[model samples]
Target: MKRFGLAAFDDQQDDKEYEGISSAVLQRQNNELKEQLAVFQERLVGFAKKHNSEIQANPEFRSKFVRMCLSIGIDPLSLFDKDKHLFNVNDFYYEICVKVIEICRKTKDMNGGVLSFDELEKGYFRRLNVDMGDLEKSIDMLQSLDGGFEIFEIRGKKFLRSVPNELTGDQTKILEICSILGYSSISLLHANLNWKPFRSRAVLNEMVANGLLWIDEQADAEALYWDPSWINVLHE
Candidate 1:
């Protein structure tokens, strides 16, 4: 007897092939959707860049941009759109940007010169709501990061180009007690630490040298004074 050709498939097998074709079609549709999303993202980035360039080219436009951002709580440095236009910023970011802008403006007013640490601290306090002490510490950290400033002496008085770092917790407590008790002597610092000071007067002397503390010229022969700036730095 003649056998049927293999091409003569069973009905059940035909149904399975039809289902496989349908699954393949669905996967193609999904891939097409993803491609469309990518194209949309690219278009958004292009729009953002166009607006940013427009703002940067005109100072009036930049000021307007800042105003518009402020109206909507957008910080120019914090969040950017698809094109990197800053938007939707929190209060902290806005404050930081404002302070930085003020500093830039002040530097311009000063004929492109650096502001003294005291001047900078006052600006920070007035513009950013940062305490004087906190301002000093932050400035110190910034100077350390950028290496642009240092403490100096002029005419037998001290001034800082930048404040030094705040003391550690233990150092802070010891220093605080010494300040309150009118003890600037190394012995006082040691006594405050239960007579087990880590580095001795050598460390205290180094702090003084670095402008972190001071030796009183008018107190008892052995009196020392924790720099008032240290209090500001630590508390701030």
Candidate 2:
């Protein structure tokens, strides 16, 4: 029995020694990987600096560069230290943010601070010469300021909401129906959604008050509530 006890103690010691060796090996490998990543990042910073002019001047080049960095789990923007003017990509996105805000503010009355991504692309992106990725990044940066810049999807259609008010569930449902039919009337809501007449009317009226829905009193029957964003689509 004493011999057996000694044998067990030796086995435990061997197991602990194996674990220690495995841990040390893993730690060394992790350190080596981190060092490699650091070297790669430094090289990338150099490359970005060398081509800074092209990256800023050519949107296609900038997009490809940004995509390559992203694929490697790096943000090209991070290559620039806060004080480094020549390496700064933030300026590019900052300009986009300013332009987005200006467009939203100017069209707030026409679209009620809610514009479809398609409309935005058609009306501004071509002139601004930026891609959707750039606009999305600018939107993310603006979110920190809490200025109600957000993107929401209804029925797979994306719209930028520039207003501070959050959409209620009922309001969103109405919007989804509008996405399908281009307009929502009290009868349509009741027939399709099983909503009571007053419930449909109340939500529709509230949206009209918010400038989210335009009233078509000239419809053959009941007034139809329409999304202003669909006006262009209707014409097309």
Candidate 3:
């Protein structure tokens, strides 16, 4: 009887402790949500004021507003309650939505006209504080959306596409080396491989031309950086 009583007491204590931790986590999440909502509200208000006439006249604004709200884990069509779908969404949804909206708004403002897909992406990279190559996977996610953009080529130079995707196998390998070594220099990659140096350098050059890699011209010695999308594959 004594052991049984002690066991029950321990279980109760554990239950109480768990409940406390759970409560604390819930409270923290709620606070974060409140702060995020405040920022969203501020941005929305600014966007409204900045493009009052355009917003009012455009049907796309309503769709985008609803999408933005949904992305932020809120159902714009339903009552404004945070707990309605508590189990259905995670914190990342709200975080990413906030980031996306901020980027979109900034793109709209900076372009001084209707923002193109490429401009929005430029804004996204700037907001995320990531290099263009590092943002490829996240860019893929954006491309999956209805208005996703893609880059096009005119003459010999390539430009940003409204939509982007994962790198090809060879491109992936090149990016992997660049990301891992933090250098995309043709000579470096060639020396590192010690085999097929010229072929590898040519491929790297092609990738740069395709925007799968970027070069840092400001560096005293030029350095190549791979797109972040290839990081996972390289690790595997």
Best candidate according to TM-score: 2
Candidate 3 deviant stretches above 4 angstroms:
1-166, 191-195, 216-236
Error of 3 at 215 (Å): 2.4
Judge candidate 3 against the unseen true structure and give its global Cα lDDT, from 0 to 1.
0.51
CA lDDT of each prediction against the hidden true structure: 0.51, 0.82, 0.51
Best candidate (score: lDDT): 2
RMSD of each: 16.7, 14.8, 15.8
What would the TM-score be for candidate 1 when compared with the true structure? 0.34
lDDT of 2: 0.82
Please identify which of the two predictions, 2 or 3, would achieve the higher lDDT against the true structure: 2
Question: Please, what's the RMSD in Å of model 2?
Answer: 14.8
Residue range 15-42, candidate 2, lDDT tens digits: 8999999999999999999999889877
Rate residue 42 of model 1 by lDDT. Answer: 56
Candidate 2, residue 19: lDDT: 95
Residue pairs of candidate 1 with colliding backbone atoms = 133-232, 184-224
